[model samples]
Target: MLIHGVALMALAVAALLAAFSSIQKAGWLAAASVAPVLAVAGVLAAWAAAIHLTGGEKFDDHPWV
Candidate 1:
């Protein structure tokens, strides 16, 4: 998870740099847009991992019989 965060941050920085160099507004917008999604995905992954490590289940088990 830490590695993923670091990678995402690095990519975000790279994207920012690329955005700065590009002439098209869409290029800058496209580069800026991916960072937040990556960040959010990383956070959600860590959260889900923590829950799994703590023995929490994503769904409740109910006996039907």
Candidate 2:
């Protein structure tokens, strides 16, 4: 999940840069499409980190066992 979050953020940044650099409709569309995806990924990443850090719950009983 962390990896995904980082990847999505990178994609969003790239798309944003492209959108700003290009005045084409497709560039704007690509940026628009990725905006929400990035937002959701960011939220999930933060939520997961919060839960993990707070010791909310664990999916595995003994991860190494």
List candidate 2 stretches off by more than 4 Å. 1-30, 58-65
Residue-level lDDT tens digits of model 2 in 1-65: 55555555565566555545543545666667665565555566556555545655657668677
After superposing candidate 1, which stretches have Cα over 4 Å from the reference? 1-30, 57-65
Q: Could you tally the backbone clashes for each prediction?
A: 0, 0
Error of 2 at 29 (Å): 4.9
Predicted candidate 1 versus true structure: per-residue lDDT over 1-34, tens digit per residue: 5555555556555554544544254565665765
Q: Assess every candidate by TM-score.
A: 0.41, 0.43
TM-score of 2: 0.43
Q: Which lDDT values do the candidates have, in the order given?
A: 0.55, 0.56
